[model samples]
Target chain A: MAQAPVTTRGRGGRAGTWYLFLVPALLLYSLFVVYPLLTGLSYSVFSWKGTVRDAFVGVDNYVGLFTNEAFRSKLLPALGHNLALFAGTMLVQNTMGLAFALAFSRARRGKRALQIIFATPYLVNPLVIGYLWTLLLSPTFGPANTLLRAIGPDELAKPWLGDPSTALPMVILITTWQWVGFPMLLFSAAIGGIPAEYAEAARVDGASSWRVFWHITLPLLRPAIGTITVLSFIGSMNTFALVYALGGSSGGPAGSTDVLGLLFYRAAFASGDINAVGTASALAVFLFTFIFGTTILLNRILRQGEEAM
Target chain B: MTPRRGAVMVPLMLWGYALVAMIPLFVMVLGSLRPTQDLFNDPIGLPNKLYLSNYTRAWTEASFSTYVLNSVVVVTGAVILGAAVSVLAAYPLGRRKFTGRGFFIGYFISGMTLPGHFGVLPLFYLLDGLNLVDSRLGLMLVYAAGSVPFNVFVLSAFFRQLPGELDEAAALDGAGPFATFRHIMLPLVRPAIATVVVFQFVPLWNDFFYPLVLLRDESKLTIPVGLTHFFGRFQNDWGTLFAGLVMTTLPLVILFGIATRQIVAGLTAGMNR
Candidate 1:
């Protein structure tokens, strides 16, 4: 059979018009997003403050970032804190969110009402959530400690945020609280996508609810689970506001709660060392690359696993 | 397998979770209502009286009104301009094939993943070179530009979902491309536009990084920055700080409440697809 020629006359004109339509967004994005990124990368190679002329310095920023005792000291522990946050949210938050979503899905009345209530924390600004938690968890007059003292052992009522031992955990808990709903909603939607026939077949085979959930629902939810993991990983690693608000600019009583984001802010702005700004830029670039690489790796792994199945 | 048992378990669990979710907010309100002294003295006790003065203090002393106005202007300007430009850009990428289209699409989409902090110092220098620092317009530009990739990606998906037959019909009527887009395509994407507006608005309104880095003047502070000042001053005064937090959070809470259905629908649409 002879093939017919596709329409190409207006294609050029149409594409050109498309490019024309894109100009304003492209202009703004290039000016503000692309240019700044390239500049930051280049600036990381030079030594300069706000006013001084830039001088070429090679990989010194990256070297200093990895080697500097102060930087390493803070960076290492912050990595631990970030890891803790990741593990906590992935395990606790995701589990709880899934449970809520499953429950809400089965709920007859007030399903919309409960979903709204659950999702409220996610919509609240992180800064606002941080401050609100600061009040609720405050060591002095906060109700959390008071409630603990009133209902439980008085010795257990230590200043939640003030105690160096508890501060990072409290911050992570609050962080998880604010974000748990997001994954829940995602899971709920994904669950909705699974065919009702699958559940029907499982029940017909005498599978219990737990068995159905474990063997069927969770397996079906793999894509959502994968996505939520990557999203939460990136978000936790890049988290700035919650930690900053809870721990303040110093990042804690002893820099115990310090994360890379707060560390970058402090290094770039707090110390006035100007040299540190280059290192901070290097750190930021490292974080971005790390997240980008991790997400790519995760997608590949998930795709491969999906294909295997 | 009984639907009756399933129904009962679900609501009970939902109500339990809802109460847990609402406790912190309730604490915030109660804490804000208590006197400063009473807050320290009787942390869990009922407020001696509802002290509305804290709101006045938060508004004037913390300069929250300026923050509110600044946030309003920045968010409004960003949404209107950002959405217009993004829709325009997205239409071509989504609808038509062109030379370097892949590269152009990649360029825009990459912005979504690039961390904003990486560009902070350079942006500071860039804005300074353009003499745009410490200005609301500068903040607006940064916010709008930072948000473009996501907006473009979202709107492009939405536009792609729209059938091309409408455009064909308009063209058959002798309407030019621009008129077709203006009169036909634009109205068709109202839901997506509304989604973009809400998505961009919430983040822009609540954002702290740009205003923190670009804006130095207290008068130029947005709500997040202004709340920081209140937080600093009242580091110990839980009542006042909580009051400020409540005031700062109230608008967003009310907005979410009003648009709860839309917000959920929009998020599911954008993220799921």
Candidate 2:
């Protein structure tokens, strides 16, 4: 029934020729990705200062991440920020994305144009998005403030990125602004893929639009929701470039906007300390474990959710 | 909500968000056209005239010419190399049943979760030891290599979905694996290939992180890094900064405009996978 017989014959006869197809990618991926990952793991175990190996420190860097005051101040709060970002993205961004996707799913006129316009932001550079938002949110010269003042919300036009209290939320919003289109696109596709008959049949029974959506559409969209949830969760946890571009390496405004990615970068590159890279490797390992574990768990949960339904 | 209310609200909400998404872009374009003094004075006002000096200033004064060239070269090179390598790898893994196939698939898929930032420092050291630091070629290699996992993942899925009869038929004929891949199987997955191409193009073009870390030479800087430097040097010159920002973004916007359908389909394909 399958290609098992032919594949076995072909495999034994042309093993060398077949593997040649795999060589280029495997070689490059191993050298570029796997090698560096292993090297990072090895580096994490040693104490290095300024690119020089100082001593063999076994899990001391990992342990110190919890015990050390400076590391704790940096890492713990950054972890909190990541959780906050994950929540914001999953709640607000996913909600907004779903709303837009729902809107577009029923849209007839200007559907293509709206999708293009909304998804256009995702096409541009994240660094540029950061700077663009910075300009738009600039305290004195930005258009947002100008419009705010003109609209009689003069006091509401605060420095969006300057105040520590507002900085992380602003970062989260900007990140969402740039990427919300992606989830929307995904959800749009998922919704579009559903047969029209399901909703039509419900409507024929005098189901309200909301009722139809709640009972019929929502269950069908569970897979998409799971995918978006996991993707957004991982994406937010690894948020670095946007934060780097917008909040700077220090994750400024008193590190309120600091996430684990930025903290890892600061530990590796920005800090003038010689032993920081080793510490950074420990952070990387922690992040890898966290991300890998979370992704697997989410995938399992999503599968379970699908199976249960 | 009533069906009437829902129908009216759907388009209204979509159009409203579309306008919101575009306002910053329109503002940037208009601001780029206004003189610095005019932007400072009328931040929200339309440009009175098509002032072209800001663009000229950005093009030459900010070294965007070099940056744009570097960006194009790197993005193009990475897409071509990445697509080729992944197609080659995916053909076997997706179409053929073989020993260690599951292990190999797992190996490639492992990268999807592991953030590139994890091993980037060691990658930096590795590249430096190889004397590839501050080189566009080095940056291109990293981009292409990093793209393999994603490219392979998507392409292999696509390849598997193609009917196996084509491969068997080709095999029944005098066609070898390479010939069959190049002739029959490859053509069947052209859309997937295009999807991979379109998908990788935008991200690689816009990526600032690897270019930031791997590249140090001023001449080799991509648009994002270049624009950041331009921003730092000319923060007060909002006109030129806006112009630089527009220049940095215009290619992508134009690309999106031209290939909106393909881009949308490609994005949806990945998400639904």
Candidate 3:
């Protein structure tokens, strides 16, 4: 029941004419993605009153992100938190995921069941994960405090999510916890893909196991390492649902967990200003530039590192 | 001694990680089954008895039934239509070498790296202009479009992997491109398409960003958005919220149980691309 816009203008009877198959998807993509992207860029330059473009404001909204007192305070922390989230993920996830992958790749028995367990948390919603952590860490009634008090001292069993000092780090840890399986899985697959002979040859040379991993296995898994790092960077930059679920839109506990995602949501929707659209669009563009720019930069460095390896 | 240490260490690390991983789920499942009063009283203990009432309360009183229906509709709509479009798009892109072929591949592949937030604000307005704001179809279109770039990238690789001789053989037998694609090609890449469908399904099902921003109607909210609303309304009742969380997550948990292989394969395949 699908039409291909028949025309008798090809060399090979049916298979010769390409781009005909591209007609529908390109049309839909252009209508949806390409168009909105351009218009959104245009919106970043214009002042908007809800839906209508009011005036061509020419980067004032962008300027406001840094100079405006109210916006600057929020934006800077949100940006810092995003970076902190990235660093935390890079350190914790890479170390844990890589360590776990190194172990799991050699694992033979009960691998499938273990795979299911590692894969389960990431399968669920990140927002739901946030809620789970919040529930588990509630100071008054959360099991974390209860268990801590049971094991250690009462003072040590302080509020996890309620205290500003611990909120962002806790959120970052919980976020990393939910996603640690993915990199673990990725690294395991990459490790498995490496031929058996490389390690055998190293061991045949009387190399230590740690040396085998450091010298032979790691260099080969460079591409996978690059992939995981980039993915983690992108994922952390778009940190919204989890943070929102944990700390609410204000990213509470004195905004310790405030992030660019929540900031954009506030600028775009929650601010209740008539001119919110313009500023929000500006934030969207800014987020895009920051995320896209860093991603490109990161790939270049990673690629260089890959080459160096 | 070294071999023994390796054996013990690997199993210990993996099994230990698994136990820690299951704690949230264990607590969630156990927490959901207990009465709210009991949960607060003994936060970490086993429930004295199975309490099915919280599930019923979340299902009916919180209107999660409607939310789940809305989520299913949006997810199914997005995945099905997106897969269809991606299959068609991947055909020419995958098989034939033509001028600007790299450009087309780069264009769609670029969408994978580019964050979705860029177009969201204007996208909302664009949908509004089409009178689709707050509509499930509107949300579905956005999601469906969002899925295309990744699916096309993945599916195209799958399509490319099939031998070219099959296409030539079909052409010589008087089969048109359409028929060859339908009968021969579509079946060969069934695993790949399955992977794409799953990769698309999880994100779309879990997404709350679009629904939160573009949809205003409570009746039409997807599960994630509905979940936030449910939590807000029942802030005091962690039992009901836990129940909601369990109900929201179970389908995905079951999906993982069934398709863990496909998910892992998809991850590796996408990385290779």
Residues forming the 10-long window of minimal summed lDDT in candidate 3 chain B: B163-172
The TM-score values for the models, in the order shown, are 0.89, 0.89, 0.89
Give every collision pair in model 3. none
Tens digit per residue, CA lDDT, model 1, A1-309: 111111142474454666688889999999999998897888778776654647788887888877989788888888788878888888888888888878765666778878878877877778888878777766666688788888999887787888888887787788778887888888998988989999989999999998999999888888888888888888888888888788887788688788878877777777677576677777777777877898799888987777786
Candidate 1 per-residue C-alpha lDDT over B1-273 given as tens digits, one digit per residue, 9 for 90 to 100: 577787776777778889888888887888788778887877777776657877787777778788888888988998888998999888767766668778988999888767777789789889999999999999999988988998888888887788767766766688766887899988998888888887777778788887878889989888888888878887877777878888878887787768766666666666564
What is the TM-score (0 to 1) of chain A in model 2? 0.90
Regions of model 3 farther than 4 Å from truth:
A1-9, A12-20, A105-112, A190-224, B1-13, B96-103, B163-190
The 0-to-1 C-alpha lDDT of every candidate, in the order given, reads: 0.80, 0.86, 0.86
Q: What is the TM-score of chain A in candidate 1?
A: 0.89
lDDT of 1 at B161: 83
Cα lDDT tens digits, model 2, A200-266, are 9999999988898899999999999998998888888878778877878788888888888778877
Per-residue accuracy of model 2 over B112-205 as CA lDDT, tens digit each: 7567768898899999998898989888888888889988998998988887677777777878889988999888888887878877898898
Using DockQ as the measure, what is the rank order of every candidate, best first? 2, 1, 3
Q: After superposition, how far is residue A272 of candidate 3 from its true place, in Å?
A: 2.8
Instruction: Give the backbone clash total of model 3.
Output: 0
Q: List candidate 1 stretches off by more than 4 Å.
A: A1-19, A49-55, A102-109, A194-210, B1-14, B47-51, B94-99, B158-188, B260-262
When just chain B is superposed on the true chain B, each candidate scores a TM-score of 0.88, 0.91, 0.92
